[model samples]
Target: MDKIQNQVRPVFPFTAIVGQEEMKLALILNVIDPKIGGVMIMGDRGTGKSTTIRAIADLLPEIEVVADDLFNSHISDYDLMSDFVKNQLENNANLTTSLIKVPMVDLPLGATEDRLCGTIDIEKALNEGVKSFDPGLLAKANRGILYVDEVNLLDDHLVDILLDSAASGWNTVEREGISIRHPSRFVLVGSGNPEEGELRPQLLDRFGMHAEIRTVRDASLRVQIVEQRTKFDQDPNSCIKEFCEQQNLLKQTIINAQSLLKSITIDYSLKVKISQICGILNVDGLRGDIVTNRAAKAFAAYQNKKEVDVDDVKEVITLCLRHRLRKDPLDTIDSGTKVSQVVDDILS
Candidate 1:
């Protein structure tokens, strides 16, 4: 395990990324306010969608987690722990803190049900006549990120499991006379090529925002991207050394932004605007309004604004509300196009 950890390469730097500003902004917004659920990036292959997400993971500031815990429980926020941990604390057990790597757990497409939710240790059960529950990817992802590539292609059963866990912030398993439930609260990020398969509407609604990415078309930008990648591949050590300083600076910026998010307020006018947008778009349920409001506020916070304004709301509307919009049967209008129209009308 130590050797494997040592061999793992660092993710690309988020600040050095080019193009896909909308996708980048939406992701940053979610990081600022995880209550906004998480952003889904859907687009063509080779559009840097996955690359951008992995890069952001590297730029994120480290978090303090409970030592020896399967779930990366935040040391500062003990209130968010499961009942089991709460009970342990109530019994006056020593709770240790350790600075751990902030998680960015990737869910592979070929993952099995056992790998997703975990299963009982049959060997231990048979030998010691005891039931022991092993933690899975979801457990390790707690208080951090759970990234799924080719999300739309994930098995139907796995999708259901993820949806339920994400909504409740817990994963419960019951089988073979053993029942276990653990905290699984993590930012759920998914990326996929929309052209290959469309995500189920139910799952789509769970995401707070969605961004579409496309390959950079500008000749110079494309050349720069290729040149940088080639240079990095040729000399990873020097390339990473050169970029590490900027990556560290960006990590600090994210930490500052997180602290700033708490002070940023949302104006009543902007709240009304968010509600109005949801009403005009005919989006179902109150989640749309809530997510849009939160995302706009986070965007403002990221910009160092004290309060959310019309521009902030407008800028983030396409990202927040796009996935929630109803598809038109007669019209093939893209979500972005519809959102732009609404923003223009509201601002005008």
Candidate 2:
């Protein structure tokens, strides 16, 4: 029964997902250049937030990792390697590698700190003199994606923990003076219904981009979404087969973009303009400027372009800055609108 339950299920192809272009673009941009950080998606309920996220993760190409490593340590990068992998390397051990689907870990709202960050078995340390540290979700999420549904409803402290690891690209566990650190670098994707609540500005700012989605209002598009979903539900395998071409095309596009991203460059003048917008808006930090630059380059790469232009920066400037703006409870202007206005004034 357990084996049957653990069998992999077919995912709805990412290309089949209709609408929510902003959310999809943000997710893709982050995947192309993880240095752009991750995205925060707030939307109406049942707006395909979770489905779209999962589809993108499933769409990603497999990565090679050191076999049997709990952290899914990259095959080469020392920083991304786990301590165990490092020790083996120091002892001149040859590491076996395996290809695996990019991990997509869901953070349940009720998770405790110890569960989220991992815990050290104090007894083993004291008695056996061995560090029996049990890995948690962050450890498993290395070189993958950590998704938090209903992120606004999650505890603030937990949100901090996630953002810290996402920003620093590492998770450290300490117990009874035994500290264990491992690579926890992963694309941090969080989605929630804005109707329920909103993450605080500080926590929201930690996310690289903000994408807002609403339920599809067009009757024709609505019908298409429903029919497509019905088809997928009726026969997941056949439905996936139907869109296999589009899915493969998109997956290849992402791979190409990732390879092209490093060569993608942005103009210095445009970067100065990005910072100007942030300054005019009184954005709290340089994250807005930095993310905008990275996202613009990623956007360019995604389009198979070698250099970022004004349009590329324009396309992502709002997403990169919207969540970082200071909240004025009395102000009526929407944050996104404010960002757009500033961008237009400066970049135009």
Candidate 3:
């Protein structure tokens, strides 16, 4: 039998995207520090939530991964596959490393539970009388990004599966006398129109940050967006060529930011401020505090700063903890308004 060919898919350019700076920043922060967990973008439809995520493919730094691994396992000290792969390597075993662009797999709304979790290859097993594990989206998304559109409308079962995988950084499956476990760590990026439905609280809590985006109301910006999009649709090759230089520069900036992220430090004062903000907001768990601190650090790193400052903390607090705040019956305060109030109180 002939081997099947895999085709490369095109992704939108990050530099070409028009607006929604907050969403772009949140996604960039997560990439700089995956320990920030993930980001959720909830807003009106057609506001470029999905486009912004797809654009991420252009900005990611290339990663060195173990060749032929189901999870695109990283060859690093902190890698989840370090134990297994290291043992194999120490036994005079040979391992190949491949330079691959980071993955950004989309989980469609209609995806089945099994498809998301992976399942047995019954056909392959029956014909060959051998057990074969058919990898799923989660497996392919390892060490990359997993984007879900209309996430609020995804089935409850799928949401549960995602939460479990996101929490453990691994996906485990058992059935038909087969048990399999694989590293499934991926930065989760979920976008949805909040008006359509509410995301389950369990799933919502898994997100490290949340950004709300709306359509560009500025007439000039809107016009420019439309014109640029029309031009790209009409002549994709030339249109992309026109922006390729800028996009490449932006990609390098991301690579530089990632390199700097490791050296960025968080100040004790800023840590207290982050804690105070979360405490004032009455956020329920320690996750909020951890994410806010990490995001602030990443934001500073992105700005090429060596230390986190109050401004960086203020800028990322809303994205990190807005969705985790306690609501007051009489306040009727939106997350944005509440965040602003907190910043004002802190800065004052």
54-118: candidate 3 lDDT, tens digit per residue: 77865676788988777787766455673457667778678898988788899988999788988
**How well does model 3 score by local distance difference test?**
0.81
Candidate number with greatest lDDT: 2
My TM-score estimates for the predictions, one after another, are: 0.92, 0.96, 0.89
Question: Candidate 1 lDDT (Cα, whole model)?
Answer: 0.81
Write candidate 2's Cα lDDT for 182-204 as tens digits: 99999999999888988988899
Q: lDDT (0-100) at residue 221 of candidate 1? A: 96
Assess each prediction's global lDDT (C-alpha) against the native. Answer: 0.81, 0.91, 0.81
Model 1 TM-score (2 dp)? 0.92
The reply for model 3, stretches above 4 Å from the true place, is: 1-10, 76-87, 120-131, 176-178, 328-330
The order by descending TM-score is: 2, 1, 3
Report how far residue 4 has shifted in candidate 3, in Å.
16
**Top TM-score model:** 2
